[model samples]
Target: MKAIVKLVILLFCVTAFSQGQQHVEYKKVSNNLIKATYYFADNSNAIQSEGFFNDKNQLQGMWVSYDTEGNKTIIAYYDKGKKVGVWTYFKDDKINFVTYKDNKLIGVEEKALVVN
Candidate 1:
């Protein structure tokens, strides 16, 4: 009886820690662009990252990353694989905005996060 009980407990533990497999879905948007979305492994229907890739498989357009809980953690922009426009990063209670021109850092801005 004790051995059976131990086996049952072990099985329960294994199932508890097992997680669903994560996957990525790709879609062609234009001749030069393909959208890729990565989903979470826990089957929560949450996206880990979403972005566009150019024909050369280079990062292009807007890219966004989120935490496991579906909170946006980073927002970035790219053009022909070069960093362009403003990128926003969420860290703790702060939001940082960084500007880039031709992959060069141009400016930076920071603001406190407001919680409702």
Candidate 2:
């Protein structure tokens, strides 16, 4: 995990786009925290996104999002709803990493999108 954290992870503003996400669905887990899994609006019943929210309703831990075709679109981390640490974005044959500290972008790296 330490080695992964040291790898490139960088940023793109997701705030405005996620505004409509206010309607996303989440459920309470054994820890009494919310575990959310958004679904594709279509009939595929595929998961569109997934993450956990803290007691204070803040996003925490690893959050993952999938594209319409079921391809992973992004892997992001948050603490108390603030973008922190490494975030990865996936595009056609390209991968972008965004690193953040206290919601501020610290670095960026782009490379071939590798799948294994």
Candidate 3:
């Protein structure tokens, strides 16, 4: 029926538009670092993750991740491929701060998410 055909067409269009191609970009920066950026597949092409890597392809420096809604989800750091410094995690109703030293968890703190 025409109604059925229209429904199918609508579904197809919605599916096609909802799907987007994900991509990543890597660029060499000063101090022998490779900056990497990952983008979400949604039509908005929002950033999903970003970080840096050393010349040896080891994770280094600051890294960040975002959710599909472009909200910061995690903030982390590394030193010579070893986890170090404080990392922040954003949850649905709370925030967590985790500290690391030489890739070992040192401390953790959690706080409620407050909205004005």
lDDT of 3 at 79: 95
Question: What lDDT does candidate 1 reach at residue 26?
Answer: 96
Off by over 4 Å in 3: 1-22, 42-44
Which window of 10 residues has the lowest lDDT sum in candidate 1? 14-23
Rank candidates, TM-score, best first. Answer: 3, 1, 2
Q: Which candidate number maximizes TM-score?
A: 3
Q: After superposition, how far is residue 76 of candidate 3 from its true place, in Å?
A: 0.4
Q: Model 1, stretches more than 4 Å misplaced?
A: 1-22, 42-44
lDDT of 2 by residue, 10-113 (tens): 12235445543434577888574689988865533678899999998898889999987788999999998899988999989899999999899999999996
Clashes (backbone N, CA, C under 3 Å), per candidate, total: 0, 6, 0
Better by TM-score, candidate 3 or 2: 3
Q: How much is 112 displaced in model 1, in angstroms?
A: 1.1
Q: Tens digits of per-residue lDDT for model 3 on 1-116?
A: 99999999999998898685578899989778999999987644789999999988999999999998889999999999999999999999999999999999999999999998
Clashes of 3: 0
What are the TM-scores, per candidate, against the unseen true structure? 0.74, 0.71, 0.76
- Candidate 2 ranges with C-alpha deviation above 4 Å: 1-25, 114-116
